[model samples]
Target: METASAESVRKHVRVYVTVFVALMALTLITVTISTLHLQPAAAIIVALCIAALKASLVAAYFMHLISEKKLIYAALTLTVVLFLVLMVLPVSHFADRGL
Candidate 1:
C-alpha cells in the first residue's frame, strides 16, 4: 500500500515538473516572439493566445482543475464566456467607431 502511494506521488511530481518545464519553454517562446518585429495586432493576438495556453496549463495541473467536478467545469466555462464577451465589447465598440 505504501509503495503504491509513493509511486502515485512520484507520478504526480513528474507531471508537475513536466508542466513547469513546458511553462518555461512557452515563456521563452513569448520572449523570442517579441523580438521578431510582428505587426502590433498580430503580436497582441499571438501573445494573448500563448498567455491563455499557459494559464490553462497552470489551472489544470497546478490548480488540479482537471479532476474537478462537472459543476466546477460549468462555472469555469461560464466565466470564460463572460470574459470573452467583455473582451470583445471594447473591440467591437472601437470597430463601430472606425478605430
Candidate 2:
C-alpha cells in the first residue's frame, strides 16, 4: 500500500511537470510566431490556435477537467455553443449591412 501511494505521487508529479513543460513550449512558440512577422491574418489565426491549445491544457490538467463527470462536460458544451452563437451573430449581422 505504501509503495502504491508513492507510485501515484510520482506519476502525478510527472504529469504536472510535463504539463508545465508543454505550456512553456507553447508560450515560446507563440513568441516565435510573433517575431517571425507572418501576414496579419495568418499570424492571428496561429496565435489564436496556440492560445486555445494552451487553454485546453490548463483546463484539462490544472482544472482537473480530464476526469470530470458528464454534467461538467454538458455544461462546458453548452457554454461553447453559446459562445459560438454570440461570435456568429456579429458576423451574420455584418454580412447584411449592405443589404
Which number leads on lDDT? 1
Q: Residue 66 error for model 2, in Å? A: 1.1
Off by over 4 Å in 1: 1-6
Candidate 1 residue lDDT tens string, 1-99: 124477777888999999999999999999999999899999999999999999999999988787777898999899999999998999999999999
How close to the true structure is residue 71 of candidate 1, measured as C-alpha lDDT? Answer: 91
| Per-residue C-alpha lDDT of model 2 across residues 1-99, encoded as one tens digit per residue | 124477777777788899999999999999988999999999999999999999999999878787778898999999999999999998899889964
Summed over model 2, clashes come to 0
Model 2 misplaced regions, further than 4 Å: 1-9
